[model samples]
Target: MQQAAPSASLPERARGVIPGGVNSGQRNVPGLTDLVITRAQGASFWDSDGRRYTDYHAAFGPPLLGHNDPDVVRAVAEAGGSLDLCGVGVTEGEVELAETLVELVPSMERVLLTSTGSEATFHALRVARAATGRRLVVKFQGCYHGWHDSVSLNVISAPDRVGHKDPISTGILPEVLDATLVLPFNDRDAVRAAFAEHGADIAAVILEPVPHNVGCLLPDQEFLVTLREECTRHGSVLVFDEVITGVRHGLGGWQEVAGIVPDLTTMGKAIANGYPIGAIGGRADLMDMFSSRPGAPVFFAGTYNGHPAVVAAALATLRKLHAEPVHEHVFRLGERVRTELPPVLASLGVPAVVTGYGSVFVTYFMDRLPHTYDDLLDNDTRMFVGYRRRMIDQGVFELPLNLKRSHFSYAHTDADVDRLIEVTEAAVRAQLADEGPLTDMDGTSTMGGATRC
Candidate 1:
């Protein structure tokens, strides 16, 4: 590893003002001081000390078109009319953005915008409760719905403590915890059991159809079908939190891919090409509940609900995604990684599972592909973290968390993917030096391994 430069002092100085020297807990790398990033463009960013890295973090999925996409930048610039707090109704850009969203998204009978995925999820829950007149909500274990009291339980915890009804953060009210019922992902029997027992009281059954929080675990067809059938039978609203999967998986995300429409959907991340925006869209009747025209309203409002310039950026982003081969490029690279990375681990004798869909993927040190979050608990977390540190040293940038998923955007090239493969093989060799290879398969393929690096 390189010696720490004086530039490291910036984060130390930030600690005096910001708690933990960062705005979000996820940014705090476990075994190393977080780098202070100075600038970013296209598929790479440089740290404060001028260290360059090909970024796979993608700001946790906001950079769908990559950093500073000129289309989004130009749109924002053209709409340079910044003071969007125009408390007097709506802007043309916001309306255009909303229309684009309604057209592209499967469940968008109506649209409501917010500035963050957390707020969108929170509002979606409120609509479910109000529409169904129920109090309890069912969320999957380890499927993060943001840091709100309603859905913050079990997103992160020690392995032994992960599959329970514990709150992920402190200061959440007990009532909030009680109102949320946490269940394991991809376990059909668990969902059936929960719905059977609390069917009458379950207002919403919300999950990330593809759970990306605790690594990338896909849904069993039976599991998703069962969610739809059971929720319909029990009169509970089904909500797909597609904040990370949206646009990256497809225009409509999980809904479009799976062909199952949730009553309400919360989208962000890739929606705005890295701009700050979130949207909740669904059936007209349910969304209309937000309007107090005749009856009571659901109390959903935000100051930056549809900031003009941000909306323009989102519009341009959606247009580019619609008119371009964005998905083709992302899925091609993603499929290459999925096909090739397993052999890399196999040759190194590292028992692991590489899981993902579309442009989001995660590497887990496990015996097989994880069926649920519980399945991921038995691996060597230290080895994974060590491998991540080694990859950083090799200039392949990823969030230094042990098991966070890697994200990719349209800006990454085949050459960048070559660097990713090279760095990954080196990291595996460094961290798994004494370990034996897990599988008998070939691992000498020079293949793509970019995405959530």
Candidate 2:
């Protein structure tokens, strides 16, 4: 196996002052810990120690176009010199982005801007409740809407807890879980039963149209159609959490692929090409609930909502996505990776499956592709952990946690895919050859590559 680059002691020392040695909890995996990143460009990143790697994590799914694209940087610089924040009124960039989004997805007649995907879902849920006058919300077992208490339940919960409908995280009030109903994915009968039992009380059914949280599980055509029909039959709103699948799939996202229009759609991550921006979009009639009225109790307001810099970045990103054939390139690159990577793993006698829809994909170590979170739970995590470690050592960066899916960007080329597959094959062979402690390497304890709160 390859040796790791010299550790960045500065970040480790700064950890004494900065809690957990990182700004976000996701950045700090217990045994697979690393310090601050020094720089990133295109599909590659360098750590503080100057070690370079092909970045498959892609900023946790925001770098659809790639990191530090010249167009996005130029847009940010221009917008930074002028208007940065627009608290209430509309800006030219914001209006342009909103109009472009509506044109891209005609089902979205209106949109509400926010700073993060979590905030977008939070506001969308409120709008649904206000419009339908309902109290319950239904979400799938492994679909993650964001960090909000209401939608945070059942995101990769254990099999036992999932079967019992228990919240995945602690400190969430029992009442919050009570208002949220959890069900298995791709289960038409279960969804039908949910609508039958709480049809009158369900305000919305929120889910990632293409679930990526647990290894890019795609729903069947019948299941997508069932959600559309069932939501219409009952008065509940159907929400598509396209935060990860928004532009990664197509200009219109999973809605276009599935051929089903939802009542509301939440988008983030790549919306601004790595700039912090989120949008809640849907039919004008339902979105109008956000307007202040005597009887309307829904309130959605933020100081940084549609900030000019982020909006300008979004406009530039959208323009690039439209002006260039980015999606076509993404499809070509995706096909190469999906086609070439798996067989390479198999050649090395490593059990693996490459699953994804469009530019985003995951390398899962399982006998077959998983259809649900339960299937993902049964995967060989030990092998995955070993493989991930070897990949890192071989200068390929994926999410240290195997459970969390990795992503690809338009910046990744055929050459990048070739290098990744080559390194992955070597990594697997190395892992299979080693008999060392699978739990520890180089004095760092491995976290088993499992992601949880």
Candidate 3:
């Protein structure tokens, strides 16, 4: 195959070959469709046009230690030099990594490794079905488990599609959609109703615990407790999809903070600090369903399940996290952003709410904070995306999309947070100056187009 000519722009040439000129659909920013990153290091990435951006997107919350950290790079290099894939046997790095996970995460008596968060969730669901001998899986409306058929539906749904089975993609079997029950997050009555009607057939109740995908909807303690209690009473496995909240929130994951232990926990993202690694850990009895021997109840196999270099990266990241004041620093910076941003927004006459846990923040363009996916319908998507787009134009790299979380890494400094606030103020000023202040004339945002939900 012939490659495109050197004279062509990167995005243009990429479009000739790759779908949407990007590998992932999420990478294709809404208005800024051709944004191309060249290289990244500690808290910032350079664009193809030689523009530097202080990164808060953090590659969708995977680069917890920041991009291309020296420790992770060095560990990966050393492991690559000495170890290569030996598919039949586990490497020492893999065992040590698994041991660290089991030791750190709250719900792990046994662990299975995969290469992506989606794969981890996939295997977790399989294990749940095997353990319970049931077909129904319960998930929250805004909580995204993965791209798999079982749990892909009902995230970021349109207003018209809310409270319905709205699959994020096509080609999912109707039966798969029917088997998965989607309920509103933090709604105890809906949860009780689901279990009350179909408790006997419920295989699992899975959630993000925080639902960071919708820009960090904090879980109500009562809601989480209800989920735990219902899952226990119904003999259904409780699966916490902590792929975004795992090591990023703390070494023990969100379950540790929430004081609720799920039967199975799927993790990734911050685990390897940007490396391609994912894992599912749970009660030994349920996890033991997978075996390499014949007639295993659940078949779990991946060629690169425990790649030596990735394992080395994970170990090094975890070690650095423990050795350094990582959580303290990032959490402080996150708090600073959350605290400082509201004043800036208010000064600029932008009605917004800032909310997140440690090392994460999100700006929701609404008067009040949201507790459920239905409440998010009030979010002015126009102002949300407009403000972020303006920030990106000023070289602050927040993903210019609605309902996306902004992340902070260990490499970020107080200076970065200040810069973010400075850029945000300027962005909101420029937006308001260009377009008049918000009005309820048509019951929608007049900044851009109609409010999209």
Candidate 4:
């Protein structure tokens, strides 16, 4: 791949204008200069320097159907040309989208649309508290539920800091952090202990049904079943933060896979195929709290909650996802990447593990796949940075940080996967030859050059 000239001028100017030379911190890939994307289509994006690369990140999991999908684009443009925002009123598109969602996820009887995943989660937590009359909430480490202060605790924190709760942001009040409990994911014992201590006071236990942050970590069947039973026993609401995993995993999500239902499930990202939209839906009884009655205290309102354009896009995306059987392609593509990529890394004597479900997964530079944020932190960071730079240079777009994960979409083909794997293999070989072996931040080589699969 020919090296594109670095466009440092815009980012340098942005440093003084924008807070972090970017709107979102996640967009700022570390080490290499930030490449500003100018245009995107199916499975690829063109940076400001006119370099095209296969977009494996998929805009952090929203582009399930791919960037600028023609169907979604047409829907959005047609809807926006007429009705853009119909606040507080029932639009035909909104109603149809809601109906589509309810039919797709049988667990979701009623759906309330919002603008972003964070707002959906915030509103869901509020509904849970109102329904249960409890103040406490529980979440697992490494599971990011957007930027809300409540769910911001324990996300991607250092492993040495485990067992002690830490807030990701400074503005989050100590009282708020106190109200939210942090626990290790895939560990029923930690959840059991937390419930034993403060189960009665807990309003909800919110978690990413399939955690994609800090590398993809899937929960065990027993762990999910135990959560359902315990939440039911304590009369606490179980909230599945399926913002990333919702339609990406399947039409039904992890709940469908695990055979357990959550009282409330939050969905975003691919729900609208890159359009900005989020939804919280589940049992009708719990969702009834959002009723706009004259006397009801519970309030959930957003000016653009069900914007017509987004609704139109969502309805189109969902219909296409189901009608076209996108999940089958996603699963097939995911299997190829996960199975073939690990051995390529191993052949180069690079220790790494590919962990995740469906099309969204992460290649962690570790020996054993991580179970907790602590375990993830024990993996190689410098090696990941090096590999990311090399992969990017080789026309593959991946998250440049160790803690962050990569995503794939339905738009990806076998050729895309092969290209990505080839570039990854080259990157792994380069890193191993140049750096000898990858080591954790603490300079440990526990991650022997071996494949966990």
- Candidate 4 ranges beyond 4 A from true positions: 1-8, 291-293, 436-453
In Å, residue 2's CA in model 1 sits off its true spot by 33
Q: Tell me the TM-score of each prediction against the true structure.
A: 0.92, 0.93, 0.95, 0.92
TM-score of 4: 0.92
Best by lDDT: 3
Give the higher-TM-score candidate: 1 or 2.
2
lDDT of 2 at 94: 80
Residue-level lDDT of model 1, residues 351-445, one tens digit each, is: 88777997877787778887877676765565666677778887787776646788778998888777787788889788767453321012222
Tens-place lDDT digits, model 3, residues 338-397:
888898888777788899999999988888988888888887766777678888888898
Those runs of model 2 whose alpha carbons end farther than 4 Å from true positions after fitting are 1-8, 86-88, 292-296, 440-453
Clashing pairs in 1: 349-436, 349-437, 349-438, 406-452, 407-452
Candidate 2 lDDT by residue in tens digits, 1-453 = 543346737666666567977777678764556556889999999887789989988877887789999999999999999876646567888888888999997469998889999999999898898888889999998888888899877776654676666565689988887898888999999999999888999999999988888768989999999999999999889999999889888889889887899999999958888899999999888887785333556776788888888888898898899899888888888878889888788888766788887777778877888887778776666677677777887789877665777777878888888888888788788877887756532344433433343
- CA lDDT of each prediction against the hidden true structure: 0.80, 0.82, 0.87, 0.81
- Which wins on TM-score, candidate 1 or candidate 4? 4
Best-to-worst order by TM-score is 3, 2, 4, 1
lDDT computed for candidate 4: 0.81
* Order of models, best lDDT first: 3, 2, 4, 1
Runs in model 1 lying further than 4 Å from the true structure: 1-8, 81-83, 292-295, 434-453
